[model samples]
Target: MKRNPRDIIVRPIITEKTVAMQQDDNKVTFEVAKGTNKIEIRQAIEEIFNVKVSKINVVTVLPKKKRVGRYEGKTKGYRKAIVKLAEGSTIDLL
Candidate 1:
């Protein structure tokens, strides 16, 4: 089934680590749909950014437990993809 690129790529994740990766490793990070795979992610990113994808690394992040006084909660879990763009290709996300 062909899915919308917007649906496949939930949103871009901006963080210090991700920013460092983007600058030094030519990689960008995004929160992708849980059910999506590497091929779908690659296609979505390529289509949305119009850039060549060199490699993809997916990481399943588990929810983190948190507490405030007597209240306890867990942060939502999501999947993140570290996409490495091909040489000479770049996405200006900032």
Candidate 2:
């Protein structure tokens, strides 16, 4: 399936750990659309960033339960992709 890059890649996850991973491992973390696979993610990222992708790792972020007094709800769960860029490739996610 041909999916738009913007639709596949929801947003960059710019937490401290991701920052460290980017700097140390040359990988970028992103919150990707649910039900997307590595090939789709690789295509989207490459097209959007114009960089070559080496490898991709995906993980499902399980929803967490939250409660306020008697009321309770579950946080939204999403898919995360860690994309490793080719040598000398970098993405300015800012």
RMSD of each: 0.7, 0.9
Per-residue CA lDDT of model 2 for 1-94, tens digit only, reads 5889999999999999999999999999999999899999999999998999999999999999999999999999989999999999999876
RMSD (Cα, Å) of candidate 2?
0.9
Q: Worst lDDT window (10 residues) for model 2?
A: 1-10
Poorest stretch of ten by lDDT in candidate 1 = 13-22
Query: How many Å off is the CA of 16 in candidate 1?
Result: 1.3
Q: What local distance difference test score does each model get?
A: 0.96, 0.95
Model 1, C-alpha of 33: deviation from truth (Å): 0.6
> Which has the greatest lDDT?
1
Task: For candidate 2, give the lDDT.
Answer: 0.95
